[model samples]
Target chain A: MQRTIVFDVLNNDNGQVKAILGAKRFIEENPEYKLILVGQEEVIKNTLGKYAEKVEIISSNEIAHKVISPRDALRNQSSMLSAFNVLKEGKADAILSSGDSGSYITLASLKVKRLPNVSRPAFMPVLPTTTDKKMLLLDAGANLEIKAEYLNEWAKIASEFHKIIFKSNKPVVGQLNIGTEDYKGTEIAREANKLLKEQADNYSFKGFVEPSSAINGDVDILVADGYAGNIFLKTLESSFLGFAKLLKQIYMRNLKTKISALMIKKDLKGFKAKFDYRNTGGAYIVGLDKVVVKAHGGSDEVAFYNALNQIKIALDNNVIEKLKEVFEQAKEGEDE
Target chain B: MQRTIVFDVLNNDNGQVKAILGAKRFIEENPEYKLILVGQEEVIKNTLGKYAEKVEIISSNEIAHKVISPRDALRNQSSMLSAFNVLKEGKADAILSSGDSGSYITLASLKVKRLPNVSRPAFMPVLPTTTDKKMLLLDAGANLEIKAEYLNEWAKIASEFHKIIFKSNKPVVGQLNIGTEDYKGTEIAREANKLLKEQADNYSFKGFVEPSSAINGDVDILVADGYAGNIFLKTLESSFLGFAKLLKQIYMRNLKTKISALMIKKDLKGFKAKFDYRNTGGAYIVGLDKVVVKAHGGSDEVAFYNALNQIKIALDNNVIEKLKEVFEQAKEGEDE
Candidate 1:
């Protein structure tokens, strides 16, 4: 059986032609997957050449209109909304976008709707750790003002998502905080801790985890409000990039150092690849009725291809169906 | 012009003997400065040997008693508290402690008291950036719950501190947020942004800065609530250590890489030093009536000595008196 994946090829830094070519390559690699390119038909055909014939085109004149900013994107619907409409109509198994995340999230929530019993949707991204395993950081930047219940829901959603994606039967969920102590953090954190403890039967609750522990692979999933989670993720990213930049400066210091750098260039490249966000595809907009993966806005061809691969994985593994079943069961238990 | 500095040689990982030696060396190098060692008399005398005669000892048997954790340190009065008492009584010009930060902060706030009209005290630490200039990150981990007013006060205090220390006429203050957009974050952030904007006359308001911009030195002072600030600081520290560990593993993979590593070992050490918190001494407990510096609990001899050096600078520069005058003038203006 083939699955249709909608690719939003607008507002990305790589330009529409490059994104369409990336999507065409993805379709060629995976015979079981098909693409619906949502952008200008003439531009897609001209850039993709022979490959454009394979993908279904959803033409939109608004694709080239400047969004001004993320705030502007959020206030008005862009061409990316056309992509989500296809997903909502059951024409696509999953949707991938490299546009404004805030706008995509808002449009997805309004158009596709939320899962049963879920008050808020979250952005769950897999982060590479020092160990062989990867950690899931949730609520990356969806809801700014989060209640205790939202964190509890995120933990549950992430745990199931982890099980489906990573094949872990029982994943440990850690709430992000300033300290690992039970009594640490704000009023919302303490309340969420209690709720998570009570629901330990559903998932393994690992009390509190600081930002360092989250990066060190202390737990399978780390959950937090969008504000703290965003800061934590951005800090880790910036620090990694900062160190890389410093190393480049050192490597280029003199002729002697440049020779030494060349001696270990292969090893350094491998190390840099481990911290690259492009390799991880993009974050999943969890708790949505349909599958939506947000690729980096500045994504290149390689990054866009990985994001398309992620959607293929999600569709193959029945992630959306499994998530819906879990929430439905929980609601049934509450009703009884 | 000489300053009397009290060193709290308790709760540090280097034990009393090693801490005493570090302090002894600091006093010997600076003939104009005097020392007051706060610890058990027997341990101080036994460790000091010949240096014992030159310094004063404020003995406390409770110095050897285990503090257990930061929470335990917060509840009881320890030897570090005895040192704070000395500073409160005007016996020492400044105080430096290498113990549990929460306990030190609690004792300092209780004994030394806060400056008039200051609701909460904060920890302000200098972090090295890619640029030649260093950045001041405040409220590193003091109050868990912060209001817009607290941020307003932090900007005012940090601006004054920056003007005195860095000799800048006006410092630019950046509030840490998820985005630089005007309508990006929570209500707290929105309110604080408005307050910071209104007070642009007193200091240069750089607007909201993401975690990456903060580390890259987009502004002179980065202000955030303790919860978010601690996470940001800890994430940077952990990420730097993680990358260093990864590089070491890569370098030690083969004989060829090992030789390359040895060739760049000196440059690597220098690069690592720029990100070291120990080199910056420790974070200062700002908004207090007196000078109090909190060194890392696991600080070694060199780190402890640098912390003491920080105290000496604080005292010699009349930081306390200047801060008091600033607050007093502000209060007078408010009364009118």
Candidate 2:
């Protein structure tokens, strides 16, 4: 049976037409998957051309006009709401978007709703460490002001998400902080640390993991408030880019170094790929009723394909169903 | 013409005797500068042997016993207080310590006091970016809770420090945040951004700088609350260490890669030196009445020497006096 995957393509860096057309090959390759393009009908027909007939189109006039910022995108929410409505009405199995993340989250939470006992959904992205391991960082940018209870809930959600996705038992959860000491962060972190410790039987709670150690890839899941988590993610991205730029300058210094660079070009590519965010497809908005993957706004064709594959995995694995069961069991235990 | 530098050696990672012995060569080389060792008398004699006579000693049994953590170091501050007392009595020009930073900061602020109109002092460290540029990051770990007013004053202090150290006429100051947008951070960051904008005439305010962009060497000064600033510094350190480990694994993979690594050993060393924290010495405690450089607890002999050189530069430039003059003028403006 072919499962339908709806992609919102209104607010990406590349125009809607380009982003939609770029996904043509992905739709063609995944014949078992049904592609539903949700945006302006005329533009989809004009840009998608003959292939427009191969995929379903959900026309939306509300988001046709340009939105200047994420805040603006949230105000005009026609396309996102329509796409999410497809999932709400059982017409689609999953939703993928490269548009404004804040808008996607806001719309999804309103229309799709959260799982039982979950206050807010977190943006969980899997980032590759220097080693062979990959760690899931949560609350990447979903909520600005996070309470200790939010971090506590995020930990439980992330642990379940990792187990289902990575098939890991007893995953280590660490609270992100400036230092590894138990007493080394803001008031929220301190309170969260205590909560994590109390729930040690549920998950393996590692003490505070510094930002630097977090990248080393030892911990299974790193939890933080949106502000700190977003800063850490951006800093890692910038550092890798900066380092790549430095390597380019070094290799291009003289003909001798250029020859050396050419000799080890294959090895260098493998090394660089380990730090590329595109390889992970996209960050998942966990704790939601439906699977929502927010692909990077600047994603290319290949990156977009990877993001689609991520949704396929989530739907196939029944991740949300499993999480709901876990939360319900925990709620019942508390009631007892 | 001679200036006396008091070195506190009680709570360093290496024992007090070993740290004192490590600086013997520095004392011998700088014949014009007097070295005052502040520690237990018996320990100094046991370590210095014959050369103990050449250097002055300020013995204190108060810090003879062991102190375990930074909190403990703060409470047991005999050696630190003794060293600061030398500065207070007009007997020493500068003070250097490798003990607990919290202890050093607390003792310095209490005895030395802050400059006029300065509410809180900051720990400003110079770090090298990917480029040839070096940046000053303030409130590195000085205050756990920072107000917007502190950031405003720290910017003024950093601008003056940059002028004296880097010889820049107008230093570009950037507020550290998760994003560069005006509406992209916490309430404190939003307020600080406005304050920085208003004081644009005092310095070249470059607006908010992301942690990633901050390390690219574009801005002269990067300011943040203690929590974010400390995390950024630690993350950079951890990332560099992680990258180096990855490179080692890559180079040691096979004989061919090993041969290639040998060919670029010199180039790699130069590249690594550019990001070395030791090259810029230790971080300075700015806005204090006297010069205090908190050298790294694990600093080697060479790193300690560089830290001493930093103090020499600050003294020669009369940084504290210049900062007082600037703050006094600003106070007058506020009154008017």
Candidate 3:
């Protein structure tokens, strides 16, 4: 079976040519997959070379500029919007973009039908943790205001994806809060905590977790209101980057330290590799019918290639189909 | 100009004996100051030695256990409560304790009156950044629910303290949000953003900032609602600690990296010292009548010594009195 991915090859910082480079490499490796390249038609054809004859290209030079309102995304005639249109028309099995997150989330939510029982979609990203296992953090910045039911809904959907992505039988789900105590956070967090506990049969529920829990890799699927989750994600990213920069300064201090750095450069490289964005690919714009992913804005050819593979992993495991089955079955039971 | 500090030498994880050791050192160094030690009388006298003759000891063996409600702290007969009472009755210039945070906050706010025009108190900690400067982060978990005014109120009070502590006349202030965009985050965040911008004369306001701003030391005082501020603080600390642990694992993997680690051991120690809790000493429970500082739970002699010095800087600078004058003068203007 051939799977087609709608690749929005414009709006990324690195330019369309590099994105096209990524697409060409992706097609060469995965012969069974089809590509729907949406960007400058001439550039796409020119860069793709030998693979140009195989993949379909949509001529769209207009890139989606970051917009304040979600409604504005639908009205735009940008390449990102055009790509979403292709996915909406069922011309592709999955969609990937390195466009503006706000616009991408808007288009994904508006164009793609929600999975059964999912009221609002969440931004889910598989993040590297201290442990060998990767952790899935959701609502990374999509919904700032959420209700208690949203947590329960997102948890049920995310747990299914966690099982597929991490291959864990019963992934531990934790609600991010200011503290682990029962009465530690806002009313919404506490309310969500009680709601998650009641219907937590499908996965393991860790009532409330603090930032240390995320750092220690104490939970598998960490769910939070978009505000806290997004801040946590950004803080974690910037802290690690900042720490690495500081570490670099230490190693470059003097000849003695510089020699010490050279002596163990390979091990340091290996440590750095653990945090490579290539490994995690991009964040999944989850709870939609299609396998929609938002690639990093600064993604290079290698990053895009890995992101395409990430979407492939989701499609191969039939994660959306599995989630639909579970939620639909639960609905049927309630109706009965 | 003799000053007295009601030292609550209990409820810390390190035990009362360690706290007494810290107080003993503090009293020895600062001969002009008096310590109203609240703990087992025999232990306080026995440990303080020569300094015991100079200081006052409030005999209270019970430690302030963590409480669910603010009212519960008022009812407790713990040494922390006794210490608060000492500050309450105009017996001490300031107070220090390594007690339960919630309980301490409750006692501090209830026992000590709020500064003029100050509606609520906040937790302010001096945090280390990559730059040589230290940052002041407030509302670190005191108010989970906040209005637009709380941020402005906290900012004014924190700015005064920042000036006293860091000796910066025009410290840069920033509001921590999900994003720096004007349109991002909740209604309160946007409203607070506007409110802060309007009355940001005391300190240089940097509108909205992300976690990177804090990590890079781009701002001096980062203000937020208790929930977000607390999460950011915890995440920043745990991330630094987590990275260190990971770095340690890398160094211990083999003999070569181990030798390299030894070669750069002193530099690493210097880096670690930059984040020592002992140096920052403790978190100041701001917006109160007196200088109320809650020391780190695991504080040793040096940490306690530094925390005492932190209080001295505040008292010596007359931060609380200066804040009172500023707010009172502002209130009088509003009435006129």
- Best model number under TM-score: 3
In Å, residue A330's CA in model 2 sits off its true spot by 2.8
Compared with the true structure, all predictions reach lDDT values of: 0.82, 0.80, 0.89
Clashing pairs in 1: none
Q: B106-155 in candidate 3: lDDT tens per residue?
A: 88888999988888899999999998999999899888889898899899
Query: What tens-digit string does per-residue lDDT give for candidate 2 at A166-211?
Result: 8889899989887777767788889999988887655799879988
Give native contacts recovered, as a fraction, per prediction. Answer: 0.79, 0.52, 0.88
Best lDDT among the predictions, by candidate number: 3
- Using lDDT as the yardstick, the better of models 1 and 2 is 1
The list of candidate 1 runs beyond 4 A from truth reads: A61-77, B63-77
Writing each residue's lDDT as its tens digit, candidate 2 over B221-290 gives 9999887788778777777777778878888887777777777777788888877766878899988878
Of models 1 and 3, which has the larger lDDT? 3
Candidate 1: docking tier: medium
Deviation in Å, model 2, residue B200 alpha carbon: 3.0
* lDDT of candidate 3 over A141-257, digit per residue (tens): 999889998899889888888888778899899999977889778888899999999889779999999999887899989999998999999999998898898999999999999
1 or 2, which is superior by DockQ? 1
Pitting candidate 1 against candidate 3, the one with the higher DockQ is 3
